[model samples]
Target: MEVAQFIIQILNGLSYGLLLFLLAAGLSLIFGLMGIINLAHGSYYMLGAYLGLTIMKTSANFILALVGAATLVALLGLIMERVFFRGLYKQELDQVLLTFGFIYIFMDLAKYLWGGTPRSLPTPPLLEGSLEIFGAAFPVYRLALIVSGLAVALLLRLFLEKTRTGMIIRAGVDDKEMVTALAINIKLYFSIIFALGAFLAAFGGVMGGPVIGAYPGLDFEILVLALAVVVVGGLGTLRGAFWGSILVGFIDTFSKALFPSFSMLTIYIAMALILILKPSGLLGRMELS
Candidate 1:
């Protein structure tokens, strides 16, 4: 029974970690590629949760809710990037202040639209059950979360590594001026990347809503966790994001289960150790710092 419990906990950690990756990946990309200090990224996640909840309640379709929320947030991202963020590029302080301002605006909008009550989406009927793994009944929804995260991760990896657009984006990350010199539309690229990042964040939010619920301060909570993931995973590297998410996810889940009173402390301790031992993170590029 003890062994079974441990295995279940590990599975839980993996699901949670992958979810963290979904949030961190886009963040890493924006910061690494575009050098935008978007403190309001978490607000997109909150927005998605609220929008997803509303759509799920009305349409009774989780997939549609996901699509709707992601699309809307992506548009929002585009608008913010083109109108507000474009001039602030590389001006870290200005970017931070602007995005920070948006955070409050978004939070207020959420309260006005959805009220102050917390909301949660029910697990879709198709995934509302459990599957026996090693004699323990693990939640099917969690298993699905794991699968979805992995699928998205794999697709993103391919998009980054295998596609021409991915190659250009990577080259842009390395030398934006050069790409611009080559007559590439840097502004358009930035807008697209920003929107893509927002889409990913919102998608993750929809997936996480059933588990974490939509609440007024959720943006701040998730922002902290996502920032932790980004920092631990090493800034600006997808590989770092993947491993960092898994490491932080497992540590957090296990600590909460085994040492509930010291969960927060344990996570920070682990982060401190990682920073001391591998300052660039496990898979992060050393040049990033």
Candidate 2:
């Protein structure tokens, strides 16, 4: 490949990786703090995309659609958590089964409303076009995604570090009982965190709708990748998610680009090698699993 082509792939990889980070961040937080395996997490992603499309068509405004979709999905997540997840937290198998059911329900619902065909979202007018760098042009939207994902990551790190409530959350992740003993409302804190994760996942879906067309099976496909990210990054680790997303993103992009003959096999090889050398992942702490 030429230098420009290589740079383009790197940009593409970084953009894709950032989107994965958004989904994986939520998955990690939910798994780490609540100890829940949410098989239906990707459903929220698909939901966000459909919602974005609907909202955009109705309002004729992309920004509003994005905001409205994210808000609606976050609300849906809150409902799911309150009605289903709260009870299922202590029951891993039950949570898995329930969420697994949700995946199919969401897929069927998407098909019924949006049809079985794929749909696309256009980049908003303001963010359309390319930026020149090292004599190569790159999509402005992809660059925006990188910036937004990085900003969110920074905001999250600050939230978990600078504020008292954030400190409580971090403490909870490390030792729930100790944090609870300090007179904190563990339930409330967890609920907020869960909602936050949902927002992240849904937001990612909305932003990625343009690049990765919204379709029926997108949820399962992204879910598998997100699961791998969580496994490779370590459950309940934010920093781990960042590193793991970048690593997996690059591996995924390059494998598909360079090793078209064995693209799928290469990902498995990478995963296996990582697991063999570092079972806990690049930045994850050892878990009981």
Candidate 3:
């Protein structure tokens, strides 16, 4: 590849990886704190994209659509956690089955609601056009995504490391019983965190809509990729998810460029190697099952 093309590819990898980080960050938090592998998480992402599309088309307001879709999904997450997941807390099998079922239910709902048409969200005019980098013109929106992802990473780090609720959450993850003993409403905290995770997924969906678009089977595809990201990044740390996304994003992007038909295989190979070398992941504290 030419130097310009290679440089653009690097940016492409970073942009795609950042998008995955948005999705995987939430997945990591939910599983790390609650030990529930939420298969439906991807459904939320899809719903968010579709919802953002609808709102944007109707209101012609991208920001409104982004926040609205994410807020609605977060509410749904809060409800699901309280109504269903709460009962299945310790029952891993039940949790898995229930969430998996929700995936189909959600997919069907999306079909019924939005039809099977693939749609793309509009990029703000402010981010339209391309910028010259290394003699290659790169999409401005992608650069925005990179910046947004980094901003989110910093914010999340601060939130988890510098805030009381975040501190309580970390504590609860380590020792739920002890947190409860201290009069902390661990269940409420869990509900909030779960909703927050959902929020992030939906936010990611909207954030990614302009690039990946909304489509009929996108949910499972995104879910699988996001799962790989968190698993490779290590289950419990935001830092892991960030770096994992960058690495996986690069692997997937470069593989597609070089071996388009077998890109996913490369990712799996990389993930397998990582798991072999460190079963706990690059920075994971939780054990993989």
Instruction: Tell me each candidate's TM-score.
Output: 0.96, 0.95, 0.97
Q: Candidate 2, overall lDDT?
A: 0.84
Clashes of each: 0, 0, 0
Best by lDDT: 3
Query: 1-289 in candidate 2: lDDT tens per residue?
Result: 8888899989888988889999898888777777777787888888888888888888879888878888888887788878987786577778778889889888998899999889988788889999987788998999999998898889888988999878888888888888779888787877878788778888888899888979989999888888778777777888988878887888899999997888867667777887898887778875557
- Decide which is better by TM-score, 2 or 3: 3
Tens-digit per-residue lDDT, 118-169, candidate 1: 9888998999889998799999999999999999999999998999777778
**Tens digit of lDDT per residue, candidate 3, span 2-118?**
999999999999999998998888888877677778899899999999999999999989899989999999999999999998887778779889989999999999999999989
Which wins on TM-score, candidate 1 or candidate 3?
A: 3
lDDT of 3 at 275: 80
**Deviation of model 2 at 208, angstroms:** 0.4
lDDT measured at residue 43 in model 2 versus the true structure, 0 to 100: 88
The 10-residue segment with the lowest total lDDT in model 3: 28-37
Off by over 4 Å in 3: 287-289
Which order, best to worst by TM-score?
3, 1, 2
Candidate 3 achieves a global lDDT of: 0.89
